[model samples]
Target: YDSCVNSVSDPSIFVIFEKHQVYPEYLIQYTTSSKPSVTPSILLALGSLFSSRQ
Candidate 1:
């Protein structure tokens, strides 16, 4: 059970958009996931981080 939960929570499932040039329009497509592996807070944090670089 622990292993299954850990696997599901694995943040690696999300693509590192910061590594590539991405526009706001396509951000939804990359961030959307059917598995619900990521939380909205995490996405907001990443969004701020990426925006800070620009």
Candidate 2:
């Protein structure tokens, strides 16, 4: 839950959940696949955040 993270990507909570390592089913509840259109850069940014957290 970082303030800076809120504004990044699509501003969708689903993106944030994936960033935090949540399950895809969980994401489905919050968002549909039709939206957000996953991108490599978003994953990279989340990966960086994950490693930093560890």
Candidate 2 similarity to native, TM-score: 0.34
Best by TM-score: 2
Summarize candidate 2's per-residue lDDT along 4-53 as a digit string, tens digits: 34456666543343355543554433545656577999999999999998
TM-score, each model? 0.33, 0.34
1-54: candidate 1 lDDT, tens digit per residue: 112222545643433335444344544435555785889999999999999995
C-alpha RMSD values across all candidates: 21.3, 21.9
lDDT, residue 27, model 2: 42
Q: Best-fitting candidate, measured by lDDT?
A: 2
